[model samples]
Target: MDLNQILAQLETANDEEIKSLLQQYNRENSHTFSFEKRKKACAKLCQSVLTVLGRQVQPSCQKTCLETLRILSRDKSVLAPVATRKGILGEDTQSEEEERVVVEALKCLCNVVYNSPAAQQVSVDVQLANGLCASLRNAREWHHEVGLFTLRLLFLLSALIPDLRGSLRREWRAVRLLREVLEHTLDVRWVGPYEAARPDPQALPMPAEDNERAMEVLKALFNLTLSDPGGEDDHQFRLIAALLRHLLMLKTETEEKQRKHTGDKSIQNRF
Candidate 1:
């Protein structure tokens, strides 16, 4: 029941044992495992979990470790080390397992920044914004899900720290990357895999998940604009155009679906 003992056990634990320890650590809400005991071991435990995350471990074990980090990130003392870790943003050519670890790391970072001012300060002090922007820029070639999680993290950071918006807007590459994603979404058509053989020029369908990811990018851009109004004039125009185009495409797709379902061509061309 001692937190230090748990930390020592976790250090040498196998995947199954690691998962068990993490689950028990996550559930330590009783008076026996008091807040003082947790605070005493929080940093060491978080460091151990982060070390595990850096290893070539099983995806499930990595996930459990990340879940533990997510919980520990609520403590201000743990945020700095977690945010400053080098390998948290897996390499561009990472395997699927590595990519999942990166996504979970981003999610853990997002939780760290959500409503914790201490964590926010640690993030800014450690230059976490630059790291997140790097992830966004590199994501063009990395896994799509990596980009999605990066955007989500940026959105949360911008929302939590008002000053971040100005800094992000000044990062021209990040702004440009968001614009490119929006433009791609505008060209997407909602078609399935079986229907992709013909390759319609005017209607190239993107996976629905891609569209959702693009929307997350847009949301981040919108959040940035709310605090930093001096986005480049050309980039601003492109963002607006891309948003309008995406909305029109969404409307057209919705109408097509309604027409097919209800057998009514005149389903209110209203938008």
Candidate 2:
């Protein structure tokens, strides 16, 4: 179907139909619709999806709309609204459903910034940087998944916009939040698959995903420190200490496992 026809259908379609059409447009190898054509209709499609996101829709519907927005975010026209919408980044995101929407909105914004410097400018122009900072602060008390997603989005935006470093450092208080998260992760001894295989009785087991998220936050802080160098004295020292401690633990555990395996091999050989 043509872009106009699809847009027309979207105007009247229910949640399920809108989702199906959006999914069809997002398909990489769709014979019926071209991304080039869809690009022309991105503004309209984005508006429709944004409307869906604003309402009390099914989780599946919300997810589909979010995925569509991520695709549409390649266009600055579509991305600006996604980034700047107060509803997307607002304090109302306390429930799991609301958090999902906020996470998706941030992801869409992240995609736009990651894809185009022009979109980054749009984001800044629309004050998306401030909005993101607010969202980050709010998500700190939310589910860890939400917090991780927010951090990932912030990392992408800061990486793209050089000027954002100062804003995040001062206005947003990103460094403090990142440090807090990193310290929390450090306190929890993360015994993952490898640790389980080795069976370290001393280690406290944490979910592998939690450990992965913590590492991602640490990497984000490291990336931020690379560009903005002044504020890292205490934060950097603590981060490095935590990292070194974790590495040393891993090394000690691995060596212990290796020695035990070697001793078992030697005994078998002697027998």
Stretches of candidate 1 exceeding 4 Å from the true structure: 1-5, 11-16, 23-44, 51-60, 72-97, 188-207, 227-231, 251-271
- In the range 1-271, model 1's lDDT, one tens digit per residue, is 6777788898788888888888787777322322344565787786787677666777778777776776776656555455552523432112245667677666666766773576677667766677778766565575776777778877787778887777777754566667666656555343442111223548645455665676677567666655335436454544454344444344323444423322421211210
Q: Using lDDT as the measure, which candidate wins?
A: 1
Task: State the local distance difference test value for candidate 2.
Answer: 0.59
Worst 10 residues of 2 by lDDT: 262-271
Where is model 2 more than 4 Å wrong at Cα? 1-4, 23-34, 42-44, 51-60, 74-97, 125-127, 131-141, 188-201, 204-206, 227-236, 247-271
Q: Estimate each model's TM-score.
A: 0.64, 0.66
lDDT of 2 by residue, 37-120 (tens): 455566676666676666776776776677677767665545445554342442123224666766665666567667656666
